[model samples]
Target chain A: MARQKMGGFNAGSMADIAFLLLIFFLVTTTMDTDSGISRKLPPMPEKDQEKSNDKIKERNVFVVLINKNNQLLVEGEPMDVRLLKDKAKEFIDNPANNPKLPEKKITDIDGKYFGHTYFVSKGVISLQNDRGTSYGTYIQVQNELAAAYNELRNGLAMRTFGEKYKELSESKQKLIKKVFPQRISEAEPKNVGGGK
Target chain B: MSKFRTKKDKGTPPISTASLPDIVFMLLFFFMVSTTMRQQDLKIRVHVPAASEIQKLEKKSLVSYIYVGSPLQQYQKIFGTEPRIQLNDAFATTNDIRDYITSEREARDEKEVPYMTTSLKVDEYTKMGVVTDIKQALRKCNALKINYSTRMLSSE
Candidate 1:
């Protein structure tokens, strides 16, 4: 037999094969940017302590309850979610600036030290949800509440710093945060199966 | 002068496709580097909700995922159809969260420990009870930075 020969395999088809696979992945995979409703969670409870109502005055409290039936109860009255942001803003700004409202204007001395002391810490948003509340309604309410705070901060940031809230310097951002702190105190979930 | 110029090889050699495979290979390697294959075989069904205000979790490594959804048909025999929380690969319960977070924190780069966040991949139809429990667990551990993993609503 003649000396054995080692033959080379043609590599020209390699690019065509790779292109086919590339096309497959290009069509099949979805390059999605993950996003969400960002909110700061409350600290853990030390114990099963009953929440005291005396600390936060009635005017400063914006109570929002979402029940199993997907209905919203603001303070004590039933309300549509579309109006939540405005109502929250009104309560926070208290545009009425009623003396009974717990909001306090910044004193010149306080204003000098702190750039934007719009409202005091008494402004609390207590969100309570049922165990059965669907995540959709829960998130929608959370988004609206967060939006309320964001709008407040943005408005003040603009007036005080002449910049949007997110665009402000770090120190300025801290000052803004002190004024419009997000006090969304989430109570323990209550009633789990109405999960529609 | 034209006759003396020796006809300048008009054929032009087919644009030298010798580098075609090399270019395609380069693209293939790029996609290979950038693409992350399914991190794990999802044993559960997760349909995250959509919202108007959204923010991307900055670093994938700094965030630990908590998947909450019902088991798939294959896992139904073991985990049942009820909505459950998953940590890494195994089907876990609310109680497992603390230890899981700790271990995951320990497994990361030492300096990155402080920036750890819990990304809750919760299904839209799921009840708030489980998500709340997980949140509370995260809070108790002081792993409070949370990313409620959500998709953007197609509308502005």
Candidate 2:
């Protein structure tokens, strides 16, 4: 019996194995990174933190509530998310300057002047959610709210600084941010109208 | 003269197959390098909700993740089916969140601390109870930069 020595290992199936691994990775790999709603969390309330709710008038407070049903209630009335941005913008800009809106025009040393510039600190958006609210609906509401602020800032930046909000210099961007500081205040999740 | 005008068939010339492995190897390396392994073997099943508007969280190195979802199948018997929070590699209650945020901040350069952000990857259907608690804890730690992880969808 002649024992024939085969040279090393088999390479016949190597390509098949590589292709299998490549396909596995190709299907599972996620190059499109996770994106999100970037928000600044409010600091933990201090023991002596002053409660200033009395200072903000009813018209100055744009209260948005999301019951467990994922339904939106802007300023105590049930509203659809579709109408949220405009309602929020109207409230923030107070285009009508109807003292009824949470918006107010004030002079700031930043130098940019406008006919209907709302005082950033005067307008407040208080958002409350239910314990049973779906994250998707909650996020959509947040996106609409944030989009309202972004558009306002961007429009103001375009008009005041001759550049988009994102394209402005750091100092100029800071000024815009200071003027329309994001003030989405979250309230405790209430067990409003959803399942126990 | 005819040889110049007419092509001679050497019984169908064989195409070179030598570089096949090299080409495939190049692709393999590219994927291997670019592919980020599933970090923090998720104890909770997090399917981030979809949204129309999204912002990219800048400074990848300054970002940390907090996942919230119902317990996985095996752990359901012990941890129950209720949604739970997972910080880094393990499941944790809200009590541990402050520490987690502090440790994550501690890992960063001092100057970069202000730029650090926490990405909350909460499942779409998960209750917001746990999420609110985590946020409160994060706020106490002054890790106020929060990014609610969401998937981007078109057509509203």
Query: Which is the leading candidate under lDDT?
Result: 2
Off by over 4 Å in 1: A1-30, A47-54, A105-121, A192-196, B1-16, B22-26, B29-37
Q: Which tens-of-lDDT digit does each residue in A1-196 have in candidate 1?
A: 2333544456678779878877666655446555786666767666888887767667778899999878999979999998999988777767667765556656322457453433454577889999888887898888888788889999988887788998988988887777777888888787654453
Worst 10 residues of 2 chain B by lDDT: B4-13
**Local distance difference test, each candidate:** 0.79, 0.81
| DockQ comparisons of all candidates to the true complex | 0.45, 0.45
- Weakest 10 consecutive residues, lDDT, candidate 1 chain A? A107-116
Per-residue lDDT of model 2, residues A52-159, tens digit only? 775667777899988777888888799999899999988887776686776554646354453344465478899999877878788889999998999999998998
TM-score (C-alpha, index-matched) for candidate 1: 0.80
Error of 2 at B125 (Å): 0.8
Q: Pairs clashing in candidate 2?
A: A60-A102
